[model samples]
Target chain A: MDEFIRIEHLNQRFDLSEPWLARMIYRRPKKFLDAVDDVSFGIERGKTYALVGESGSGKSTIARMAVGLLTPTGGRVLIDGQDLHDGSLSVAEQRRIRQRLQMVFQSPYASLNPRWRVGSILAEPLRVFRLVDGPQAEQARVHELLEQVGLSASDARRFPHEFSGGQRQRISIARALASKPDFIVCDEPTSALDVSVQAQVLNLLKQLQRDLGLTYLFITHDLAVVRVMAHRIGVLKSGKLVEEQATEKLIESPQSDYTRMLIRSAPRIHRAAS
Target chain B: MNGEKSAWQRFLASDFFYDFKRSPVTIVSFVIVVTLILMAILADLVAPTNPFDPGSLNLMNGFTPPMEPNAFTGETFLLGTDDQGRDLLSAIIYGLRVSLFVGLTAVILAMFIGVSLGLLAGYRGGWVDAVIMRIADIQVTFPSILIAVLIFGVARGLLPPDLRDELAITVLIVAIGLSEWVPFARTVRGTTMVEKEKEYVQAARLIGLGSSQIMVRHILPNVLSPVLVIATITLALAIIAEATLSFLGVGAPPTEPSLGTLIRIGQDFLFSGEWWILLFPAVTLLALALSVNLLGDWLRDTLNPRLK
Candidate 1:
């Protein structure tokens, strides 16, 4: 189906052992939690594919596995049709795959380095990839990136502590865009920000997707944000993809009961009394 | 026009600088430490007579007392001369230089070894953590000075006896540094364990950052505040420990006498009525250690969020 990223039959089981007292009380050997039990999905190139779910629906776990931050118990993740678990793929190839699928974290305040200035924060990836020459050239490139992200070049020298919550989130977006990747997994990047700032960031992400031809795997519990930014949405529940449909189609006619409940519970402005 | 007031305001608004200025004891202690540090640094430019120079000594000026003219020579000894005809004022400066150097180098060595091990233990857990923590615990059961002596002995045993006296100061430093590292390791390990759970470290890992980058760039900076405070306190302890070791007659060579060695030499004439020999160096050593401990205590209060 012309997919850029695909996860097939993923299962993540964590061992939850009981303490000696609990074990004696329950008369059990061990317990196991199916954190993500057999979830599967795919994303098309140059589109915003979102996972909307309640807390602990394995939405974050799925995102974490997608970015190679966590290992799945049983599954295969294929990025650009290359199986990440295929024993033949070298470490360098896996790194290259990681370079493509970078994840913007959930908490904007917790994402950026507090000690680093705005400029060095952007230039870190460039220096890692050996993209720039010296400090002066790095500064110029960083300033340009900041300007593109709706920040002034003068703000480059300032520390992250100097910026507001919204401004810091924008700088994070700038850092994500620095590596020039094909795919980015934004894990609730605006959840910590104010609502008005959230809309602005969502619009910025949409504009960037259109201009840069980027693929986004957005994970969120907020359906309002999902409806605004997502072209297609996957309503995940209990570690499984319960409903998958286009954004407009899902809004028009949700076939699944869970999807309908989620849509109803989703915060809205108009026709709510109806 | 003023958005968040600025980080400087936030820093100033916090107790960091305000608490520093508020304490009179800290201010006085800070001044004393700064003056001593400057004196140690400019030992050559500030010292009146080069005590190291053989021609600078006058046997006729020997055994002079404070504020009293020498019976042998008419000129008075400000802090009084030793039995070897050395100026007490000039000797103390040289002694401070040696003590400061040894303390600083030992601390650096200990930090390097301890921090590296702590990172490995905390990051690469399982058996590695158990083994490192057990070793740290075992080391803690004994007094650090005894551990220093044991390590110092082992190190000296490895060298030929002829070089022992020659490398006396070097061996003492290495021994003290190795002994002092257990606290640093334990402190860093606890800090690294907490920091590893933070979201920024996970973000760094997700961005294809290497494990080393995650440790140094992300984890190390967060872990360093506690370590810095510990290091500051440890510097004072290390200096005092060196003095104790030297006073026990195993530290710096007699020719290049540290404060402890001067005290050791001065102890010989304390009963013979030349009390200035021991009194001056003892008082100077007391001042140095007290000032450092005061500053360290002030830093501990300032840097700690709970205390703040």
Candidate 2:
């Protein structure tokens, strides 16, 4: 497989210790919580790698680190085999590396800037990266991006509040796509939407990936969601990647007890086999 | 192509505008504020006399009562004349201009200082937050009037004697401005702290925006609503503070008396037979302050998400 992203030995530790004054008063030692404990994974070009875990399992933490939103205490995130966190890389080099990757955040309501119109939100990355030449080109590209995300061109004139939850998520996806990224980190993009809307968003994401030939790091807690979206799966348990396998093999025959439990807990509806 | 709706038309269509229309008190307050502001802006044209100009003063016309002519001069005064024979109506109009000037200038100064400090403290966090917030905490303990007085005294002492008298209003503005900033800082810091945690800020960071850019562009707009509410209320407070300082004779100079100074001048005649001199300015001040406070209260309610 042609590896587009390689996250190796990623360790993220959060200092959960009391303040200096409190520590002195209480006579307690400093403490730290390992949010991501030496995790490793890779995603192939033009495929979805889903990281599934329960809340507090550090799935979102790893997703943030993969895109350099959160820095790892140890190890490296390699994009196209280049060390993303390497100190020797100049700022421009680092930015160039980041330009190839983007993230669609959880909670579309909280993700998009409330004050900005849809056009400005989608146009930001294109302007930031100098992807398009002028304002006219940027406007045209924004309209095209909106259409690609299953929204009308006129939707760009409206505010985020004017859109439904599902529509807002589509706008967020379009924003991520503005930079023409190869690898996108989708952090539970549809978790906040209704079940029916979730299916629509998942299908849209799948269609986008297929059409754009894009790779994705899909982070979700729902096994059912990953079932249709991901090509490969990595199950995380308390900041540790417990199991990694092809989606079909892992689900057909689970190795770990946690993975087995996750599968069993997902509600199933017996459908008429087509 | 069809003609587009104006920004004003859209603004009038918003929920905020609906709220404004529904509340009679807010509408009345808005009218009062606009009337007062217009009167202040057009003081020279609206006022019957230019009290600031020495030529406009008539020593012979001093002590004339409202709607009556002076005993010796036979000149009629509408709102009566002061000891210096300045037209009471013109004096109040001119005083309003100074009062509003000091209030608005101080508020702007305070907002700028406080909002910047708050953004730095909240975004940077750790030691910076501790330092700025601690200073704000200490300032919050003292009565703002006392702080204004202390700042006024220090500023007055630092300047050259010739410039001191010349720039007393400017010094008062600074003193009141400095004292009022703690509220702006505290409110903006609390708002900035919450805004920084939002995923939009994190997304901005992911896009490689600098801390300053994110703070100014992304976080600042989100936090400004509360700050605006604070500013409106603080404008009322700033006006009152300027009045207090001037009443103490440390505010606007006698040559250019503010509402506070006019009230102070009137207090002397309060015990004497001449009462209208003090009554008119006092009522104007009361109306101005009350209207502003009520408007601010309405804004606070409208902007609050919990209320919605």
Candidate 3:
């Protein structure tokens, strides 16, 4: 299998200690929180790998590290065989690495700049990356992006607040695609939307993945979402990966008791006799 | 999507304009501010005489009360004449120009300094945040007027004796500008701290946008509403501080006196019964400052998230 993305023994420890002066005055020891511990996972090209866990189980932490938002305290994150945290790389090389990766945050409202109209937001990556020449071409590309996300070209003139939750998520997805990224880390992208809206966003994500042949590291607490979105599932329990397998096999028979508990705890829709 | 509407129509339909229309006090305050500003700008055309031009003054007309002929020269003065025979109306109009110039310029200077420092402190937390915030804290403990006075004195003392009067207005502006910055820095730093944590900032970081770009492009606009509220209030404070400094004899020089200077000159003749000298300029200053304060108050309430 082509390892398009790889995380080897990733760890992220956050210092929860008081300020130096406060600690000195109080004579208290430094404290730390292990946000992620010895977690490892990989994704092949064009496949989605879902990391399912409860809140504070290091799902988002791992997602952040995967996207290079947080440098791992230990171990490595290699994308397309290039080490993301290697400081020896030139600034241009680092930028090239970043351009290949994009992220869609959990809260759609919080992820997009509210002050910017939809056109500029969608056009930003193309402009920054210098992918398209001139304003007219960039505008055309932005219109295409809007249409790709199932929005009209005219919607580009509107602000983020004008859109409903699902439409905003769609716009965000469009923004992530603007960079023409090969890999995207979606941190519970649909979790904040309504249940009906969630399905629409999920379908959009899946459709985008199929069309673009893009890889996704889908992080969420909902196993039901994982069942639909992921080809492979990694069950994370308190900063540790307890179980990893094909999503169908895992759903059919969860090996770890924690995974079994998560599966059992997830809500299910009961179909009436038909 | 309402994309077809012109920018003017969009602005009129916006929540800000809607709120402005709903508040009668803000409307009145805004009208007063606009009228005062217009009068100040058109002082040359509007004023009956040139207050600053010594050539235009007639010493014989001195102390003529409102619409009253001077007992000595039989010259009529609309709002009376000062000790120098400069028409009170023209002097106040010209003084309005000076006051508004100093106030607006000082506020802009303060906003620039405070916003830049605040962004630096808040975006780059740890020692930078601590030091900037500590300085702001220290300044906030003292009345801003005292700080402005101290700054004005130091600045004035630093200048050469020959250039002192020439640059006094600039020094005064610097003083008031510097004094008003603490509140802006404090307000912006707090807002920036909250804004930098928002996911858009994080996303900007992830996308290889540098710290400065992220702060200016992504975070700045989000944090600006609160800064704007602080700014409108600070405009009033800055104007009052300028007036206070000028009233203390350190601000605008005698050649081009601000409203504060006019009030200071007016106060002396108050006991001798030339009340128009004091009363006219004093009322002009009062109207200008009070209107700005009311507008600022309206802005604070309008922009307040708690009220929403």
Candidate 4:
């Protein structure tokens, strides 16, 4: 199947217990929230696999684990046959692996640092990975990245606040591409934008994927977005993956009640009688 | 060149500069503080006489009132002479120099220590955070002046008696710096805690950057605005702390008296009708402290987005 990304029974349990003193006084046991259950999925090379779930369904948790930002409490995340959470890997190996993947967060405003110019923001991955040698090369690469995201090269001199929400998402996508990563985890990248802007950003992502032959684990709560973006879809409910199938088949006939309900609840545009 | 010019023009047209121009009290305080600082920095060139020089003192000129000829020397003193016959104007100028030096060095020292510790505590946030914050909590319970006094006393006790006077100013700086770092640490820690959770920091982490790299490169810049505001406010506190210590007879030595020392010397003759000694130095101290504090207040309100 040439799976480019694999999640093997991933689980994440967050400690929600009170402090030790409070627990002792109240005679309470330690409490925990299983944010991500033993869920598993895989995406083939150059394909998009979308995880659709409402808030608190642990979609973001799975996304973070996939990008190695958060280590799962149980099981493993393998990228290109390498265990991302494996402690035995050397520091250089870990970094080499990290350079192959990147993330696009939900909130465009919160994702890019406000204090930094767009040039520095895009150049960070390039600099970190030592992709370019000197300042001139770095600047050239930054300009190239800015242009690749449909922004002017001069826009690199501006700050993130100067851009619209969709443009900021483009910058975020540009940053993700800076490392020349083959795999990207996009966690609700367009959910915060307006409908028109969302379509633009989604089209940009699809265009980037087509051009770069990239693999993506696209996370979102929007079935409409998934229909346009994903080849395969996984419906997540309360930290568990309830259904997984080809996107068209699932949209046509969602097996799980939760998936059916989610599809039904999604807002639709009504047409006036001609 | 064009970019630099536009950036300057942008800054001049920013809401910050507009706010600064709008407030009369802030403008007045800003002017006062700048003038005082300039006077202190240029004291050597600005003062009428070398007040600290023993050879420059004339005992016959003692108790000379403002703009009045001395009874014996027949030489008019501008702000008058002290009990030691030193020029009050010159003494205040030199005292301003010492006061400003001590205040500035102490605040820099405190900010460095506090920001570093705060960054560590907030970023690491486990046993490291607990220990650093607990120490900050304990230090904050006591008035900072008392803590400074205690640190000064302990430091003085540890030094050799012969070097006590020689190292007194340095020791005083360290004392005030140690005592004043609690506010900076608490403030930086609070800001760092909030900043480290931001998605940029998470992105930095995901990009194979180490924890320290994320804290320093990514998180530090974001957390610096509050730190700057705290530093400005802490500078005022540090200056006042230095003055209080000097006033208590343990700060700047007699050889090089600060404003607080001048006030201490001035207060002795206050009841004996020589009130100018006490009043002049006290007024200078009040002006310096009040202006700096007002500027700090203005800065806190301006830089804080929540206030806006």
**Top lDDT model:** 2
Instruction: Name the runs in model 3 displaced over 4 angstroms.
Output: A269-274, B1-22
**Interface RMSD (Å) of candidate 2:** 0.7
Candidate 4 lDDT over A12-120, as tens digits, reads 9999999898999999999999999999999999999999988999999999999998889998999998999999999999999999989998989899999999999
| CA lDDT scores, all candidates in order | 0.85, 0.92, 0.89, 0.90
Better of 1 and 4 by DockQ: 4
Deviation in angstroms for B286 in model 4?
Answer: 0.4
**How would you encode candidate 3's per-residue C-alpha lDDT over B152-236 as one tens digit per residue?**
8898778889998889888888888898888778778888898888888887787788899998988888878877877888888
lDDT of 1 at A163: 89
When only the first chain is scored, the TM-scores of the models are: 0.92, 0.97, 0.97, 0.97
- In model 1, residue pairs whose N, Cα or C atoms come closer than 3 Å (at least 3 residues apart or on different chains), thus clashing, are none
Tens-place lDDT per residue, model 4, B122-147, is 99998899999999999989999898
Clashes of each: 0, 0, 0, 0
TM-score of each: 0.91, 0.96, 0.96, 0.97
Off by over 4 Å in 2: A269-274, B1-15
Q: In angstroms, give how far residue B201 of model 3 lies from its true place.
A: 1.3
What is candidate 2's lDDT per residue for B233-271, written digit by digit as tens?
A: 999999999998999998999999999999999999988
Q: After superposing candidate 4, which stretches have Cα over 4 Å from the reference? A: A269-274, B1-8
lDDT (C-alpha) at residue A270 in model 4:
10
Candidate 1 stretches with Cα past 4 Å from truth are: A16-31, A132-140, A251-257, A269-274, B1-17, B58-62
